[model samples]
Target: MLLFGTAGIPASTKTNGDTVAGLKRIAELGLGGMEIEFVRGVYLKDNMVPPVAYVGKKLGLKLSCHAPYYLNLNHADEVRRRQAGGVLHHAAGTAARAGARTIVFHAGYYLKGSPETVYDAIKAEMEVVLGKLLDEGTEITLRPELAGKISQFGNLAEILKLSRELPGVAPAIDFAHLHASTGRYNSYPEFAEVLNRVGEALGRESLDDLHLHVSGIEYAKTGERRHLNLAESDFRYDELLQALADVKAGGLLICESPNIEEDTLLLQRTYLDLSPRT
Candidate 1:
Protein backbone atom coordinates (compact mmCIF):
# COMPACT_ATOMS: atom_id res chain seq x y z
CA MET A 1 0.00 0.00 0.00
CA LEU A 2 1.04 3.59 -0.56
CA LEU A 3 1.89 5.29 2.74
CA PHE A 4 1.46 9.04 3.08
CA GLY A 5 3.35 11.25 5.53
CA THR A 6 5.05 14.55 6.29
CA ALA A 7 8.61 15.23 5.14
CA GLY A 8 9.59 15.72 8.76
CA ILE A 9 8.06 16.13 12.18
CA PRO A 10 4.61 17.70 12.16
CA ALA A 11 4.63 21.38 13.14
CA SER A 12 2.21 20.60 15.98
CA THR A 13 4.67 18.19 17.57
CA LYS A 14 5.42 19.37 21.12
CA THR A 15 9.16 18.74 21.19
CA ASN A 16 11.53 19.47 18.33
CA GLY A 17 14.27 16.90 18.93
CA ASP A 18 11.99 14.14 20.08
CA THR A 19 11.46 11.91 17.05
CA VAL A 20 9.40 9.60 19.25
CA ALA A 21 6.95 12.42 19.82
CA GLY A 22 6.88 13.05 16.07
CA LEU A 23 6.12 9.41 15.27
CA LYS A 24 3.41 9.35 17.93
CA ARG A 25 1.84 12.48 16.44
CA ILE A 26 1.96 10.85 12.99
CA ALA A 27 0.18 7.80 14.37
CA GLU A 28 -2.44 9.98 16.06
CA LEU A 29 -2.96 11.86 12.79
CA GLY A 30 -3.55 8.48 11.10
CA LEU A 31 -0.63 9.06 8.77
CA GLY A 32 1.40 6.01 7.74
CA GLY A 33 4.95 7.28 7.47
CA MET A 34 7.55 9.97 8.34
CA GLU A 35 10.75 11.17 6.67
CA ILE A 36 13.41 12.40 9.04
CA GLU A 37 14.80 15.59 7.52
CA PHE A 38 18.54 15.93 7.91
CA VAL A 39 18.56 18.73 5.36
CA ARG A 40 20.56 20.96 7.71
CA GLY A 41 22.55 18.17 9.30
CA VAL A 42 22.39 14.64 10.72
CA TYR A 43 20.78 15.75 13.96
CA LEU A 44 19.54 12.37 15.14
CA LYS A 45 22.01 11.22 17.76
CA ASP A 46 23.19 7.62 18.13
CA ASN A 47 21.66 7.37 21.60
CA MET A 48 18.21 8.30 20.32
CA VAL A 49 18.11 5.78 17.46
CA PRO A 50 16.68 2.94 19.49
CA PRO A 51 13.78 4.90 20.91
CA VAL A 52 12.92 6.35 17.51
CA ALA A 53 12.93 2.87 16.00
CA TYR A 54 10.90 1.48 18.90
CA VAL A 55 8.22 4.18 18.67
CA GLY A 56 7.99 3.94 14.88
CA LYS A 57 7.65 0.17 15.08
CA LYS A 58 5.04 0.37 17.81
CA LEU A 59 3.01 2.76 15.69
CA GLY A 60 3.58 0.77 12.47
CA LEU A 61 4.99 3.89 10.80
CA LYS A 62 7.13 3.62 7.69
CA LEU A 63 10.31 5.69 8.03
CA SER A 64 12.79 7.32 5.66
CA CYS A 65 15.32 10.18 5.64
CA HIS A 66 16.55 13.16 3.58
CA ALA A 67 20.28 13.75 3.62
CA PRO A 68 21.82 17.20 4.03
CA TYR A 69 21.32 19.73 1.23
CA TYR A 70 25.02 20.56 1.22
CA LEU A 71 25.82 17.36 -0.71
CA ASN A 72 27.49 17.69 -4.12
CA LEU A 73 29.16 14.51 -5.23
CA ASN A 74 30.25 16.13 -8.49
CA HIS A 75 32.23 18.93 -6.84
CA ALA A 76 35.47 19.84 -8.67
CA ASP A 77 37.26 20.06 -5.36
CA GLU A 78 38.05 16.55 -4.18
CA VAL A 79 37.92 17.45 -0.48
CA ARG A 80 34.56 19.17 -0.84
CA ARG A 81 33.23 16.25 -2.85
CA ARG A 82 34.38 13.85 -0.15
CA GLN A 83 32.70 16.01 2.49
CA ALA A 84 29.43 15.83 0.61
CA GLY A 85 29.75 12.06 0.36
CA GLY A 86 30.46 12.00 4.08
CA VAL A 87 27.22 13.81 4.78
CA LEU A 88 25.27 11.24 2.78
CA HIS A 89 27.11 8.35 4.39
CA HIS A 90 26.55 9.64 7.91
CA ALA A 91 22.90 10.39 7.27
CA ALA A 92 22.21 7.03 5.63
CA GLY A 93 24.06 5.13 8.34
CA THR A 94 22.16 6.89 11.11
CA ALA A 95 18.83 6.54 9.38
CA ALA A 96 19.43 2.87 8.75
CA ARG A 97 20.26 2.33 12.40
CA ALA A 98 16.97 3.99 13.29
CA GLY A 99 15.07 1.52 11.05
CA ALA A 100 14.52 3.84 8.11
CA ARG A 101 14.14 1.88 4.87
CA THR A 102 15.41 4.53 2.46
CA ILE A 103 17.40 7.77 2.36
CA VAL A 104 16.76 10.51 -0.21
CA PHE A 105 19.22 13.15 -1.45
CA HIS A 106 19.84 15.68 -4.22
CA ALA A 107 22.90 14.07 -5.73
CA GLY A 108 24.59 17.16 -7.20
CA TYR A 109 24.51 20.14 -9.55
CA TYR A 110 25.48 20.04 -13.25
CA LEU A 111 28.07 22.78 -12.70
CA LYS A 112 30.09 23.50 -15.88
CA GLY A 113 30.46 19.87 -16.80
CA SER A 114 28.51 18.00 -19.43
CA PRO A 115 25.61 15.88 -18.15
CA GLU A 116 27.50 12.74 -19.19
CA THR A 117 30.61 13.75 -17.23
CA VAL A 118 28.64 14.82 -14.20
CA TYR A 119 26.64 11.60 -14.22
CA ASP A 120 29.84 9.60 -14.37
CA ALA A 121 31.32 11.46 -11.41
CA ILE A 122 28.19 10.98 -9.34
CA LYS A 123 27.92 7.29 -10.24
CA ALA A 124 31.53 6.59 -9.28
CA GLU A 125 31.19 8.28 -5.91
CA MET A 126 27.86 6.66 -5.20
CA GLU A 127 29.30 3.26 -6.05
CA VAL A 128 31.99 3.77 -3.45
CA VAL A 129 29.42 4.92 -0.90
CA LEU A 130 27.21 1.95 -1.62
CA GLY A 131 30.16 -0.42 -1.37
CA LYS A 132 31.10 0.79 2.08
CA LEU A 133 27.52 0.66 3.32
CA LEU A 134 27.00 -2.83 1.98
CA ASP A 135 30.28 -4.05 3.45
CA GLU A 136 29.10 -2.78 6.81
CA GLY A 137 25.86 -4.76 6.52
CA THR A 138 23.70 -1.63 6.62
CA GLU A 139 20.60 -2.22 4.53
CA ILE A 140 18.88 0.83 3.06
CA THR A 141 18.10 2.15 -0.38
CA LEU A 142 19.78 5.34 -1.58
CA ARG A 143 17.45 7.46 -3.70
CA PRO A 144 18.50 10.34 -5.88
CA GLU A 145 15.64 12.84 -5.84
CA LEU A 146 14.20 14.42 -8.99
CA ALA A 147 15.57 17.92 -8.49
CA GLY A 148 13.45 21.00 -9.18
CA LYS A 149 16.11 23.35 -10.58
CA ILE A 150 17.44 23.43 -14.13
CA SER A 151 21.00 23.47 -12.81
CA GLN A 152 20.49 20.33 -10.76
CA PHE A 153 21.93 16.98 -11.86
CA GLY A 154 18.80 14.89 -11.40
CA ASN A 155 15.90 15.05 -13.83
CA LEU A 156 13.48 12.19 -14.34
CA ALA A 157 15.61 10.47 -16.96
CA GLU A 158 18.83 11.00 -15.05
CA ILE A 159 17.31 9.68 -11.84
CA LEU A 160 15.85 6.64 -13.57
CA LYS A 161 19.12 5.95 -15.36
CA LEU A 162 21.06 6.19 -12.11
CA SER A 163 18.66 3.79 -10.42
CA ARG A 164 18.99 1.39 -13.31
CA GLU A 165 22.80 1.39 -13.17
CA LEU A 166 23.13 1.17 -9.41
CA PRO A 167 22.17 -1.95 -7.51
CA GLY A 168 21.08 -0.30 -4.27
CA VAL A 169 19.85 3.03 -5.62
CA ALA A 170 16.38 4.23 -6.64
CA PRO A 171 14.67 7.35 -7.86
CA ALA A 172 12.65 9.52 -5.51
CA ILE A 173 10.17 10.89 -8.05
CA ASP A 174 9.21 14.37 -6.91
CA PHE A 175 6.04 15.17 -8.88
CA ALA A 176 6.05 18.86 -7.97
CA HIS A 177 9.68 19.15 -8.94
CA LEU A 178 8.97 17.46 -12.24
CA HIS A 179 6.19 19.99 -12.95
CA ALA A 180 8.22 23.03 -11.89
CA SER A 181 11.34 21.95 -13.75
CA THR A 182 9.63 20.98 -16.99
CA GLY A 183 6.68 23.43 -17.12
CA ARG A 184 4.54 20.34 -17.83
CA TYR A 185 3.73 16.96 -16.23
CA ASN A 186 0.87 18.77 -14.46
CA SER A 187 -2.07 16.74 -15.80
CA TYR A 188 -3.49 13.29 -15.22
CA PRO A 189 -2.25 11.96 -18.57
CA GLU A 190 1.17 13.52 -18.02
CA PHE A 191 1.41 11.97 -14.58
CA ALA A 192 0.38 8.60 -15.97
CA GLU A 193 3.01 8.93 -18.69
CA VAL A 194 5.61 9.52 -15.97
CA LEU A 195 4.60 6.35 -14.14
CA ASN A 196 4.68 4.46 -17.39
CA ARG A 197 8.15 5.79 -18.20
CA VAL A 198 9.39 4.65 -14.80
CA GLY A 199 7.95 1.20 -15.23
CA GLU A 200 9.45 0.98 -18.69
CA ALA A 201 12.89 2.20 -17.61
CA LEU A 202 13.13 0.33 -14.33
CA GLY A 203 10.59 -2.51 -14.26
CA ARG A 204 6.96 -3.12 -13.41
CA GLU A 205 8.15 -3.82 -9.86
CA SER A 206 9.48 -0.28 -9.53
CA LEU A 207 5.93 1.07 -9.75
CA ASP A 208 4.91 -1.29 -6.98
CA ASP A 209 7.44 0.15 -4.50
CA LEU A 210 7.96 3.76 -5.52
CA HIS A 211 9.30 6.56 -3.38
CA LEU A 212 7.59 9.82 -4.24
CA HIS A 213 7.44 13.47 -3.18
CA VAL A 214 4.60 15.90 -3.70
CA SER A 215 3.73 19.51 -2.91
CA GLY A 216 2.47 22.70 -4.48
CA ILE A 217 5.34 24.58 -6.12
CA GLU A 218 6.07 28.07 -7.37
CA TYR A 219 8.34 28.32 -10.37
CA ALA A 220 10.04 30.77 -12.70
CA LYS A 221 11.51 30.62 -16.19
CA THR A 222 14.65 29.18 -14.64
CA GLY A 223 12.68 26.66 -12.48
CA GLU A 224 11.43 26.10 -8.88
CA ARG A 225 11.19 29.10 -6.56
CA ARG A 226 9.47 27.65 -3.49
CA HIS A 227 6.84 25.23 -2.21
CA LEU A 228 3.28 26.37 -1.49
CA ASN A 229 0.35 24.91 0.39
CA LEU A 230 -1.72 22.74 -1.99
CA ALA A 231 -4.89 24.87 -2.09
CA GLU A 232 -2.92 28.06 -2.64
CA SER A 233 -1.00 26.90 -5.70
CA ASP A 234 -1.65 25.71 -9.26
CA PHE A 235 -0.53 22.10 -8.75
CA ARG A 236 -3.21 19.75 -10.14
CA TYR A 237 -3.00 17.47 -7.15
CA ASP A 238 -6.37 15.84 -7.65
CA GLU A 239 -5.36 14.77 -11.15
CA LEU A 240 -2.00 13.61 -9.87
CA LEU A 241 -3.71 11.55 -7.17
CA GLN A 242 -6.00 10.03 -9.75
CA ALA A 243 -3.02 9.10 -11.88
CA LEU A 244 -1.26 7.46 -8.94
CA ALA A 245 -4.41 5.50 -8.15
CA ASP A 246 -4.79 4.43 -11.76
CA VAL A 247 -1.32 2.90 -11.66
CA LYS A 248 -1.99 1.35 -8.24
CA ALA A 249 1.38 2.77 -7.16
CA GLY A 250 2.49 1.61 -3.77
CA GLY A 251 5.20 3.04 -1.55
CA LEU A 252 6.02 6.03 0.62
CA LEU A 253 4.80 9.45 -0.56
CA ILE A 254 6.07 12.31 1.59
CA CYS A 255 4.43 15.72 1.44
CA GLU A 256 6.82 18.68 1.58
CA SER A 257 4.27 21.48 1.86
CA PRO A 258 4.71 24.17 4.53
CA ASN A 259 1.64 22.75 6.23
CA ILE A 260 2.99 19.23 5.94
CA GLU A 261 0.44 17.06 7.72
CA GLU A 262 -2.50 19.07 6.42
CA ASP A 263 -1.54 18.67 2.76
CA THR A 264 -0.55 15.07 3.39
CA LEU A 265 -4.01 14.31 4.71
CA LEU A 266 -5.54 16.22 1.82
CA LEU A 267 -3.73 14.01 -0.69
CA GLN A 268 -4.49 10.85 1.29
CA ARG A 269 -8.20 11.61 1.60
CA THR A 270 -8.51 12.64 -2.02
CA TYR A 271 -6.62 9.57 -3.23
CA LEU A 272 -8.75 7.24 -1.11
CA ASP A 273 -11.84 8.90 -2.49
CA LEU A 274 -10.76 8.18 -6.07
CA SER A 275 -8.74 5.00 -5.62
CA PRO A 276 -10.40 1.63 -6.20
CA ARG A 277 -7.56 -0.19 -4.44
CA THR A 278 -7.96 1.90 -1.30
Candidate 2:
Protein backbone atom coordinates (compact mmCIF):
# COMPACT_ATOMS: atom_id res chain seq x y z
CA MET A 1 0.00 0.00 0.00
CA LEU A 2 3.00 2.28 -0.11
CA LEU A 3 2.30 5.43 -2.13
CA PHE A 4 5.35 6.78 -3.94
CA GLY A 5 5.47 10.51 -4.66
CA THR A 6 7.38 13.76 -4.74
CA ALA A 7 8.47 15.82 -1.74
CA GLY A 8 6.98 18.98 -3.23
CA ILE A 9 5.17 19.98 -6.36
CA PRO A 10 6.22 17.67 -9.15
CA ALA A 11 8.95 19.08 -11.39
CA SER A 12 7.02 17.77 -14.39
CA THR A 13 3.91 19.81 -13.72
CA LYS A 14 2.53 21.92 -16.55
CA THR A 15 1.81 24.65 -14.01
CA ASN A 16 3.50 25.11 -10.63
CA GLY A 17 1.68 28.24 -9.59
CA ASP A 18 -0.34 26.59 -6.80
CA THR A 19 -0.39 23.38 -4.73
CA VAL A 20 -3.75 22.39 -6.19
CA ALA A 21 -2.13 22.43 -9.58
CA GLY A 22 0.73 20.50 -8.04
CA LEU A 23 -1.60 17.83 -6.71
CA LYS A 24 -3.27 17.65 -10.11
CA ARG A 25 0.12 17.19 -11.70
CA ILE A 26 1.01 14.43 -9.22
CA ALA A 27 -2.22 12.63 -10.06
CA GLU A 28 -1.62 13.11 -13.74
CA LEU A 29 1.85 11.64 -13.40
CA GLY A 30 0.38 8.48 -11.81
CA LEU A 31 1.91 9.31 -8.47
CA GLY A 32 0.02 8.76 -5.26
CA GLY A 33 0.71 11.73 -2.95
CA MET A 34 2.80 14.89 -2.46
CA GLU A 35 4.21 16.54 0.63
CA ILE A 36 3.35 20.21 1.00
CA GLU A 37 6.79 21.73 1.43
CA PHE A 38 6.16 24.27 4.15
CA VAL A 39 9.87 24.31 4.80
CA ARG A 40 9.83 28.06 5.24
CA GLY A 41 6.36 28.61 6.73
CA VAL A 42 2.90 27.09 7.03
CA TYR A 43 0.51 29.87 6.09
CA LEU A 44 -2.35 28.58 3.98
CA LYS A 45 -5.04 31.22 3.78
CA ASP A 46 -8.62 30.41 4.77
CA ASN A 47 -9.68 30.81 1.15
CA MET A 48 -6.88 28.69 -0.28
CA VAL A 49 -7.28 25.65 1.98
CA PRO A 50 -10.57 24.26 0.68
CA PRO A 51 -9.44 24.27 -2.93
CA VAL A 52 -6.22 22.48 -2.07
CA ALA A 53 -8.11 19.90 -0.05
CA TYR A 54 -10.80 19.68 -2.70
CA VAL A 55 -8.44 19.04 -5.53
CA GLY A 56 -6.56 16.38 -3.56
CA LYS A 57 -9.80 14.60 -2.75
CA LYS A 58 -11.07 14.85 -6.32
CA LEU A 59 -7.84 13.41 -7.63
CA GLY A 60 -7.55 10.69 -4.97
CA LEU A 61 -4.21 11.97 -3.77
CA LYS A 62 -2.88 11.24 -0.32
CA LEU A 63 -1.48 14.37 1.31
CA SER A 64 1.06 15.02 4.03
CA CYS A 65 3.11 18.04 5.14
CA HIS A 66 6.66 19.03 5.97
CA ALA A 67 6.62 21.71 8.63
CA PRO A 68 9.16 24.53 8.74
CA TYR A 69 12.67 23.09 9.00
CA TYR A 70 14.20 25.55 11.45
CA LEU A 71 12.03 24.85 14.47
CA ASN A 72 14.16 23.79 17.41
CA LEU A 73 12.09 22.41 20.27
CA ASN A 74 15.11 22.14 22.54
CA HIS A 75 16.09 25.80 22.24
CA ALA A 76 17.65 26.96 25.48
CA ASP A 77 15.70 30.18 25.55
CA GLU A 78 12.09 29.85 26.65
CA VAL A 79 10.89 32.34 24.05
CA ARG A 80 12.27 30.37 21.12
CA ARG A 81 11.12 27.07 22.58
CA ARG A 82 7.59 28.40 22.94
CA GLN A 83 7.74 29.80 19.44
CA ALA A 84 8.35 26.28 18.15
CA GLY A 85 5.09 25.17 19.73
CA GLY A 86 3.24 27.98 17.99
CA VAL A 87 4.72 26.98 14.65
CA LEU A 88 3.76 23.34 15.15
CA HIS A 89 0.23 24.43 16.00
CA HIS A 90 -0.03 26.29 12.75
CA ALA A 91 1.43 23.29 10.89
CA ALA A 92 -1.26 21.02 12.33
CA GLY A 93 -3.92 23.51 11.33
CA THR A 94 -2.53 23.64 7.82
CA ALA A 95 -2.39 19.84 7.56
CA ALA A 96 -5.94 19.51 8.81
CA ARG A 97 -7.23 22.00 6.31
CA ALA A 98 -5.33 20.43 3.46
CA GLY A 99 -6.68 16.91 4.23
CA ALA A 100 -3.27 15.74 5.35
CA ARG A 101 -2.95 13.37 8.29
CA THR A 102 0.71 13.86 9.13
CA ILE A 103 3.03 16.81 9.71
CA VAL A 104 6.72 15.87 9.63
CA PHE A 105 9.33 18.08 11.26
CA HIS A 106 12.97 18.14 12.28
CA ALA A 107 12.53 18.55 16.03
CA GLY A 108 15.83 20.12 17.16
CA TYR A 109 19.53 19.85 17.84
CA TYR A 110 21.36 18.67 20.98
CA LEU A 111 23.57 21.60 21.88
CA LYS A 112 25.94 21.03 24.85
CA GLY A 113 23.44 18.99 26.83
CA SER A 114 23.12 15.36 27.86
CA PRO A 115 21.03 13.39 25.39
CA GLU A 116 18.53 12.67 28.16
CA THR A 117 18.14 16.37 28.98
CA VAL A 118 17.67 17.19 25.32
CA TYR A 119 15.06 14.46 25.06
CA ASP A 120 13.16 15.88 28.04
CA ALA A 121 13.15 19.36 26.52
CA ILE A 122 11.90 18.09 23.17
CA LYS A 123 9.27 15.91 24.85
CA ALA A 124 8.00 18.79 26.97
CA GLU A 125 7.73 21.09 23.99
CA MET A 126 6.04 18.41 21.91
CA GLU A 127 3.50 17.77 24.67
CA VAL A 128 2.54 21.41 24.57
CA VAL A 129 2.26 21.36 20.79
CA LEU A 130 0.20 18.18 20.79
CA GLY A 131 -2.07 19.40 23.58
CA LYS A 132 -2.83 22.60 21.73
CA LEU A 133 -3.48 20.71 18.51
CA LEU A 134 -5.89 18.44 20.38
CA ASP A 135 -7.77 21.28 22.10
CA GLU A 136 -8.04 23.16 18.84
CA GLY A 137 -9.68 20.08 17.22
CA THR A 138 -7.09 19.71 14.50
CA GLU A 139 -6.39 16.02 14.24
CA ILE A 140 -3.01 15.31 12.67
CA THR A 141 -0.05 13.12 13.54
CA LEU A 142 3.11 15.03 14.45
CA ARG A 143 6.16 13.13 13.23
CA PRO A 144 9.63 14.00 14.44
CA GLU A 145 11.97 12.95 11.70
CA LEU A 146 15.20 11.02 12.36
CA ALA A 147 17.79 13.66 11.62
CA GLY A 148 21.01 13.18 9.68
CA LYS A 149 23.48 15.20 11.71
CA ILE A 150 25.22 13.92 14.80
CA SER A 151 24.21 17.09 16.65
CA GLN A 152 20.50 16.52 16.07
CA PHE A 153 18.10 15.56 18.86
CA GLY A 154 16.19 12.92 16.92
CA ASN A 155 17.80 9.53 16.58
CA LEU A 156 15.93 6.35 15.75
CA ALA A 157 15.49 5.45 19.43
CA GLU A 158 14.42 8.95 20.45
CA ILE A 159 11.84 9.28 17.67
CA LEU A 160 10.46 5.82 18.41
CA LYS A 161 10.09 6.70 22.08
CA LEU A 162 8.28 9.92 21.24
CA SER A 163 5.90 8.05 18.95
CA ARG A 164 5.29 5.43 21.63
CA GLU A 165 4.50 7.92 24.40
CA LEU A 166 2.81 10.73 22.54
CA PRO A 167 -0.72 10.50 21.27
CA GLY A 168 -1.04 11.08 17.54
CA VAL A 169 2.68 10.99 16.87
CA ALA A 170 5.03 8.81 14.82
CA PRO A 171 8.43 8.61 13.22
CA ALA A 172 8.85 9.95 9.69
CA ILE A 173 11.44 7.41 8.57
CA ASP A 174 13.92 8.86 6.11
CA PHE A 175 16.18 6.04 4.96
CA ALA A 176 18.59 8.59 3.54
CA HIS A 177 18.93 10.12 6.98
CA LEU A 178 19.47 6.72 8.57
CA HIS A 179 22.23 5.92 6.10
CA ALA A 180 23.71 9.38 6.51
CA SER A 181 23.36 9.44 10.27
CA THR A 182 24.97 6.11 11.03
CA GLY A 183 26.87 5.15 7.89
CA ARG A 184 25.04 1.84 8.19
CA TYR A 185 21.85 0.15 6.95
CA ASN A 186 23.02 0.22 3.34
CA SER A 187 22.52 -3.53 2.98
CA TYR A 188 19.44 -5.73 2.69
CA PRO A 189 19.83 -7.41 6.09
CA GLU A 190 20.40 -4.06 7.79
CA PHE A 191 17.36 -2.58 6.13
CA ALA A 192 15.25 -5.50 7.30
CA GLU A 193 16.65 -5.14 10.78
CA VAL A 194 15.57 -1.49 10.90
CA LEU A 195 12.04 -2.48 9.96
CA ASN A 196 12.14 -5.24 12.53
CA ARG A 197 13.09 -2.75 15.21
CA VAL A 198 10.32 -0.42 14.11
CA GLY A 199 7.79 -3.21 14.32
CA GLU A 200 9.05 -4.30 17.71
CA ALA A 201 9.01 -0.78 19.15
CA LEU A 202 5.80 0.56 17.62
CA GLY A 203 3.96 -2.62 16.67
CA ARG A 204 2.91 -3.86 13.24
CA GLU A 205 0.08 -1.31 12.99
CA SER A 206 2.71 1.41 12.87
CA LEU A 207 3.87 -0.10 9.59
CA ASP A 208 0.42 0.32 8.07
CA ASP A 209 0.58 4.00 7.18
CA LEU A 210 4.24 4.93 7.18
CA HIS A 211 5.49 8.38 6.25
CA LEU A 212 8.80 7.92 4.55
CA HIS A 213 11.44 9.92 2.69
CA VAL A 214 13.68 8.06 0.31
CA SER A 215 16.66 9.31 -1.67
CA GLY A 216 20.22 8.65 -2.70
CA ILE A 217 22.48 10.75 -0.49
CA GLU A 218 26.07 11.55 0.29
CA TYR A 219 27.25 11.70 3.86
CA ALA A 220 30.34 11.98 6.01
CA LYS A 221 30.94 10.60 9.49
CA THR A 222 29.37 13.76 10.88
CA GLY A 223 26.38 12.85 8.67
CA GLU A 224 24.31 14.11 5.68
CA ARG A 225 26.11 16.05 2.99
CA ARG A 226 23.53 16.30 0.19
CA HIS A 227 21.01 14.37 -1.85
CA LEU A 228 22.01 12.75 -5.12
CA ASN A 229 19.95 11.30 -7.94
CA LEU A 230 19.19 7.60 -7.35
CA ALA A 231 21.40 6.29 -10.10
CA GLU A 232 24.20 8.67 -9.23
CA SER A 233 24.61 7.61 -5.60
CA ASP A 234 25.46 4.21 -4.15
CA PHE A 235 22.51 4.07 -1.73
CA ARG A 236 21.04 0.56 -1.70
CA TYR A 237 17.51 1.71 -2.54
CA ASP A 238 16.63 -1.45 -4.45
CA GLU A 239 17.42 -3.53 -1.37
CA LEU A 240 15.61 -1.07 0.93
CA LEU A 241 12.45 -1.19 -1.15
CA GLN A 242 12.66 -4.97 -1.22
CA ALA A 243 12.94 -4.94 2.55
CA LEU A 244 9.90 -2.67 2.80
CA ALA A 245 7.88 -5.00 0.59
CA ASP A 246 8.87 -7.97 2.72
CA VAL A 247 7.71 -6.18 5.85
CA LYS A 248 4.37 -5.30 4.25
CA ALA A 249 5.01 -1.62 4.97
CA GLY A 250 2.50 0.49 3.14
CA GLY A 251 2.20 4.27 3.02
CA LEU A 252 3.60 7.37 1.42
CA LEU A 253 7.23 7.23 0.33
CA ILE A 254 8.14 10.72 -0.87
CA CYS A 255 11.27 11.29 -2.90
CA GLU A 256 13.47 14.08 -1.60
CA SER A 257 16.22 13.66 -4.18
CA PRO A 258 17.08 16.60 -6.46
CA ASN A 259 15.22 14.92 -9.29
CA ILE A 260 12.01 14.22 -7.39
CA GLU A 261 9.65 12.78 -9.98
CA GLU A 262 12.18 10.60 -11.72
CA ASP A 263 13.46 9.13 -8.51
CA THR A 264 9.95 8.68 -7.17
CA LEU A 265 8.92 6.80 -10.27
CA LEU A 266 12.05 4.74 -10.05
CA LEU A 267 11.32 3.87 -6.45
CA GLN A 268 7.73 2.89 -7.24
CA ARG A 269 8.68 0.70 -10.13
CA THR A 270 11.47 -0.99 -8.20
CA TYR A 271 9.20 -1.73 -5.25
CA LEU A 272 6.45 -3.10 -7.46
CA ASP A 273 8.82 -5.23 -9.44
CA LEU A 274 10.27 -6.65 -6.26
CA SER A 275 6.92 -7.31 -4.59
CA PRO A 276 5.57 -10.81 -4.13
CA ARG A 277 2.46 -12.00 -5.90
CA THR A 278 -0.86 -11.98 -4.08
lDDT of 1 by residue, 1-278 (tens): 88999999998889876788999999999999999999999998889999999889888999999999989999999988888888899899999989898999999999999999999999988998999899999999999999999999999999999999999999999999999999999998899899999999999899988999999999997789999999989999999888888888999999999998999999999888895444
Name the top TM-score candidate: 1
Candidate no. 1 TM-score: 0.98
The stretch of ten residues in a row with the least summed lDDT in candidate 2 is 269-278
On a 0 to 100 scale, what is the lDDT of residue 8 in model 2? 89
TM-score per candidate:
0.98, 0.97
- Which runs of model 1 end up more than 4 angstroms from their true locations? 276-278
lDDT against the true structure, each candidate: 0.93, 0.90
After best superposition, candidate 2 residue 6: deviation in angstroms?
0.6
Provide the RMSD of all predictions against the true structure, rounded to 1 decimal: 1.3, 1.3
